[model samples]
Target: MPAIRPQTLNDVFQQAANQARQKLPELTHNQQVARLYRKSLKVLSSWAIDRDIFNDEATKIRARFDQARGCKPEKAIRLLREAEDEIFAYTHPDPYCNPVMPGGSKFMRNPPLPMDVCFPDGNYPADAPKYEINPDWSKATPENGKAATGYVLVDFGKKNME
Candidate 1:
């Protein structure tokens, strides 16, 4: 009868890492381009505040992508990156302009009161006392006071220690 050996932590981790690496598919240039095209189309569909306008823009984007279909690997990659950047910049759904009233993409209006002065009463109740940290070390409790020291060295090469 063969003796069964227990798997070490490193062996188990290595097996899991190898499996994860093997599961990832190596996509070809055409596949990558198709994926990007589909993803871009989906993003544009979501960004389309108005359906008709979005459809027109999407059609234009599709035509541009189609024009670069037969381009070389380097050129295709560059074109795809440029297209992604353009799409992101043009259809940015969340253009965070301050004052944030309906559609102001420029300067922010000043608040009626300063942030600190606005909340004069403070967030907590009136009865709650403000906490202040004492500089004296004698008053502080040790963070690991209850932890066992014996097992500390045994955790050498453990998952979290790494």
Candidate 2:
């Protein structure tokens, strides 16, 4: 095994100075702003369905960015973050519209089958048991009760525990 050498305070300072001397790549204020603007536009384009509407919205977004072109670094960053938040809140890529299933959205490749073809014997059951809510609370076992009480009754209609 090689012998380990102890480093002094001078050596540590020298190493830190060397690291400080080496410049790291960093984006300028304008460059960062422009990049953010372009990214927001791309996101908008992906969410938009109509070409004309997208163009109109993109133009408006560009104009907003341009208005804050001369703002200080801190102000610019704040403005950009606010813009991002507003855009995200206003536009949702996944809207609760028609589903992507066979009978819903146009994107589905498989055609939906007719009810008769899907269920040949008809979906309704010949003898289905009718459901009824039991009013008796004392019959409940301690293991199944919400509380440690011997019997706890939960009434859905009353929306309370007894």
Candidate 3:
């Protein structure tokens, strides 16, 4: 019978190194163009607040993309670079984001606590003070009576050092 050997630190590190070196599939020209167009439109949307103006600008963008298609490799690369530069130049300082989305203002505003942290081992002490989301939700524990902004800090009290 063959004995199963436990993995060493070197073996774990080698596996991780190989994974890190693995090549991602190269994007074809069409795929690259499509991604750039999508990115450009997103940037344009951030700047153009009015729907009609956005539509007109979007049409112009689509036309430009269509014109660039079927060109020689060098020209296609040049156009792609130009489009990227234009997008970067027009990138908004404060892009409009959906309130619930990751970059939005309301994201994680009233986030729920993880069950593991709330009640470890599926058990909670009955006499312990009830955990509730603070209305003010502040990191600053001010000595003064004024409320602070942001999520509340939780303290589970101290454990015996023994």
Candidate 4:
């Protein structure tokens, strides 16, 4: 697995949830949007369920792994429910920490610039009037090579775009 720690994941999830929550109120309340919001809540609840909170799964699995393992019913499901309740703490906040809920993109006519797109080098040229990923996009990769960090700049010059 990656270097994901509980603290880091919580921070990331909290930030994303905050952003999503911020976006939700801006959306027009309607049946469809409401349904989507409910669905996202369901997803959030599922993520809240954890094996670590309650060791039932581990206990059962461990027993099974044993050569003379004892067969027993899993009480882990109860632990999972408790985990869900705890996770709901962050989710219940006005600025949510979960993406499952409705948010900015879902509500906006013109979506806000995503925070993830902001990079250290810069997205817009200094001379450019507007924010863009690259000043010249059609050519090969920028002479600086490219960021192996997954995202590459998409330079959109101000006057060039409609």
The candidate scoring highest on lDDT is 3
Best by TM-score: 3
Q: lDDT values of the candidates?
A: 0.58, 0.63, 0.72, 0.42
Model 2 CA lDDT for position 16? 94
Per-model TM-score, in order, reads 0.41, 0.38, 0.54, 0.19
Off by over 4 Å in 3: 1-22, 109-162
- Scanning candidate 4 in windows of ten residues, the lowest lDDT window is 153-162
From the highest TM-score down, the ranking of the candidates is: 3, 1, 2, 4
Which residue pairs show backbone clashes in model 1?
A: none
Candidate 2 residue-wise lDDT at 142: 38
Q: Which regions of candidate 4 are displaced past 4 Å? A: 1-72, 95-162
Error of 4 at 62 (Å): 18
Model 2's C-alpha root-mean-square deviation from the true structure amounts to: 21.3
Order of all candidates by lDDT, from best down to worst?
A: 3, 2, 1, 4
Superposed Cα deviation of residue 38, candidate 4 (Å): 15
